[model samples]
Target: MKRVVITSVGAVTPVGLDAESMWQNVKQGKHGFAPISSFDTSRLKVKNAAEIRNWDPVAMGLNKKEARRMDRYTQFAMAAAKQLIDSAGDLSGIDPYRAGVIVGSGIGGFQSTVTEHAKFLEKGPDRVSVFLIPMMICNMAAGQIAIEYKFRGDNFAPVTACATSAHAIGEAFRKIKDGYLDLCITGGSEGSINEFAVAGFQNMGALTESQDCDRLCIPFDKERSGFVMSEGAGLLLLEEYEHAKARGAQILGEIVGYGATDDAHHITGPDPEGDGAAHAMLHAIREAGIEPGEVGYINAHGTSTPLNEQCETAAIKRAFGEHAYKLAVSSTKSVTGHMLGAAGGVEAIITMKALEEGVLPPTVGYKVPDELCDLDYVTEGARKTEIKYALSNSLGFGGHNASLLLKKFEG
Candidate 1:
């Protein structure tokens, strides 16, 4: 199998408009969350989110005319994709057919769907815009990305709930490893912060109803209530190892192994014992040919929700045993809030960056640790250490569990 390397990465997250800006803010533990501004959440229990602020579409290089048509999710994806494409400059030398784009989203164009549905009811079906279906479908992100970059090899979307991006990226790794394509842009995006989503999560008791927006997303804390809804997008340029070396592309990191599994247990909740998640960890480690002890840091799937944090902790203990206690595991969600489908993409970047910089990001808001979740969550701020191997985990609805193992580039 040919080796796959991540040459470049870009992000348009609530924390920042681009990767550099986002990383700087997140590293400083600066919270981007505040009272929701897109809608009047005056009557709602949770009125805050990690909403992207001060982001004018034109600021991201999008014209007002073009920005008017795209929904928030597409805008974020486009911004991230543009940055990644810029990083992989002068792709004209490579055949467009050898390039691909695979973006994922659990919910796509949600705002578009709701708006068009209202229009259909108020006006007529004919009043719906021609771009309604094409724009609102979950696969449209991938289609739009391919069209923007003229990538012709592979274009598709992965929708596995929050595991959506992990699966997309993992599949991209396989495509490159099998020599299917020389370069591929893969990641995920989501923009589902709406009244409907809030009502649903609130009814199901899966949302943080705290009035303090700044401290609502307290992942892994003993008093952690629920996940703070957020929106964002992340894109990564993946290329074959020799192809990247030949072009002297900056290798961001090497994706060594990927593993995915389904629990067949529940639709909304993870298995209490974390059987599915543990299996994913085992599979990824085996594929990487490494012992449990080799993994120095883990970007955990800690969503600040009670079930996920507890269950994921159980899974980690089951998979790594004593090594789990020795490793540094932190949930970037604690700092960035929950991005739903885009969660995996941001966490993947976090893991790769930790490997690159040898600094583990702290999981903020960890006031009182739970007994069942006994692990060193790197809470004493960023720690500088040798991170030879890093693992990123994501568990989503439908019992989806995805794990990706990354290592420092050697030889």
Candidate 2:
């Protein structure tokens, strides 16, 4: 199998608009959760969310016409893709057909769909825009990215709910490792912070109802009620290790293993025994050719919902045994406020940065830890430590479980 490594990264989240800024804010334990500003939330009980503010697509080099046809999620994906390609330097030597995109979103163009549906009700079917289908589909995030960069290989979106981007990235790694592709753009993006989305989550009892910014999404904490709804995008440039080395590209990190599984227990809830989640982590660790003790950190899928945190804790312990207690485990969602489909992609960036910079990002807003989730959570801000291997976990709706293992790039 060919070795695959991350060459560059791009991020657009509530914490920061770019990769460097996002890393800085993450290390500082800065919180991104606040009230939703994109739409009115006067009627909904869930008001606060981690929203990207003051973002200008045109300022980010997006053309006016293209922006109009795209939904906010695609816009975010394109913005992140441009950032990744630019940071990767000149890729002129690589064949565009060998390089492809695999970005995913749990809900695509949700806001656009909601608004257009309202027009259809008010002014009949003729009032609906012809671009509605292209704008609202879940796969357009990947499609638009491919169209923009002229990438013609293995382009598609993996819609596994919250595991959406994690699966996209994991599959991309497999393609490169198995000699199927030379390079790929992979990650997850989301833009569902609208009234209808919020109302649906609120009605389903899935969103955190807290109005306070600091207490919104307290992952693994005793007071954690549910996940905070948020929106953003994360994109990564992945290349064959030999190709990256030959081009003199700076390697960010190496994705050594990927594991995906399904709970088959519930649609929105994980298996109470955490069997599938544990297996996902164990599979990733085994594929990385490393012992459980060799893993030093984990970016947990701690959604702050009671079920997710408790089950993830059990799954970690089940997978790593004593090493789980020793590892510097933390949830970036505690500060980033659960970017839904984009969670895995953004968390991957945070985990890679932790391995690269030798620091552990904290699970902020955690004061009283739940006994069920007792682990070495890095709650006291950033901790400087050498991390040879780090794992990022993402458990999504419909029992989807995905884990990715990354090793520090030494060569």
Candidate 3:
């Protein structure tokens, strides 16, 4: 099989609008949790989230008129895609037909749905805009990216709830490995941090109700209540190893293995036994042809929720056994909050960066470790550790579990 590697990364996360900025803030153990400013949370129990403050598309070189047509999710995707393309450099030589885009979103244009429905109910039929359907669709991010970059190859979005982007990245890896495409823009973008989304997760008991920003998203902590809702986008430029080498592209990391499984347990909750998650991790490690001890770091699916942290810890133990205690595992969600669908994308970038820079980001805000989640979660700030192979895990709603193994790029 042909090799696949990550060439560039882009992100519009709560911590920063770009991957480098986000990584710096994340390494410093800064948490982005704050009071929700996009909408009034006076009527809701959950008043805070990891929101991207002061995002202006026009300032990012987007035309004002064109920006108005796209939903916030699409805008975020466009911004990140631009950054990825720019960072990748001179894709003009690569055939548009040989390129692809696969950006996923769990709930696309949720704000559009909420606002448009209210307009329809208030003003009968003709008031709804024609762009409503295009804007609100979950696949529009990928579609719009293809339109923007003229990538005529495979273009689609894999909506697997929170595991959406991880699936996208894994599928892109398969395509590139099979010589299906030379260049692929893959990741996830989400903009569901609106009144409807917050209210829904709040009522479903998925979000943290605490108003204190410092203690909001304490993943794996015994006092952790729930995940803090957030919205953002993360995009990666994936290229075939030969293609990237021939073009002199700076390879960031090699995606050695990808594993996906279904829990078949619950729609909203992960399996307590972590059978599916463990299988995913094991499959990824086995596919990479590495012993469990070889994995030096893991970006866990620690959502700051009791069940998720406990289940993921169990999964890690099952997959890594004794080596699990030796490896450094941390959840960047402790710093960036729960970014829903975009979580895997950002976390994947973090894993690759850790392998590249020999610095492991800490799981910020972890005060007391839960007895059920007793693992070497790197909580003592950022640690200097050389990581050869790292795993980024994402377990989403609807039993979707995905894991991607990234190896340090030597060349």
Per-candidate local distance difference test: 0.86, 0.91, 0.91
Rate residue 85 of model 2 by lDDT: 84
**On residues 1-411, what C-alpha lDDT tens digit does candidate 2 reach at each position?**
999999999999888999889989989988888778887888989889888898789988788899999999989998999899888977888888789899999998998999999999999999999999999998998998888888888999899999999999999999999998899999999999888888988898889898778888888899998898878899998999999988889999999999999999998998888899999988998988889899999999999998998999999989988888899889999888888889899999999999999999998899886889899889889999998999999999999999999999998
Clashing residue pairs, backbone N/CA/C < 3 A, model 2: none
Off by over 4 Å in 3: none
True-vs-predicted CA distance for residue 69, candidate 1, Å: 2.8
Local error of candidate 3 at residue 118 (angstroms): 1.2
What TM-score fits each model?
0.97, 0.99, 0.99
Model 3 vs. true fold: TM: 0.99
Compute the lDDT for candidate 1.
0.86
Q: What tens digits encode model 3's per-residue C-alpha lDDT throughout 1-411?
A: 888899999999999999999999999998898888888888999999888899899887677998899999999999998888888966778988889998899989997898899999999779998899999999999998898889999999999999999999999998998889998999998988888878889888888898789999998899999999888999999999989998889899999999999999998999999989999988888988888899999999899998999999999988889988999899999998888888899999989999999999999988886889889999999999787999999999999999999999986
Query: Model 2: what TM-score?
Result: 0.99
Model 1 residue 153 distance off true place after TM-score fit, in angstroms = 0.7
What 10-residue stretch in candidate 2 is worst by lDDT? 33-42
Q: How far is candidate 2 from the true structure (C-alpha RMSD, Å)?
A: 0.9
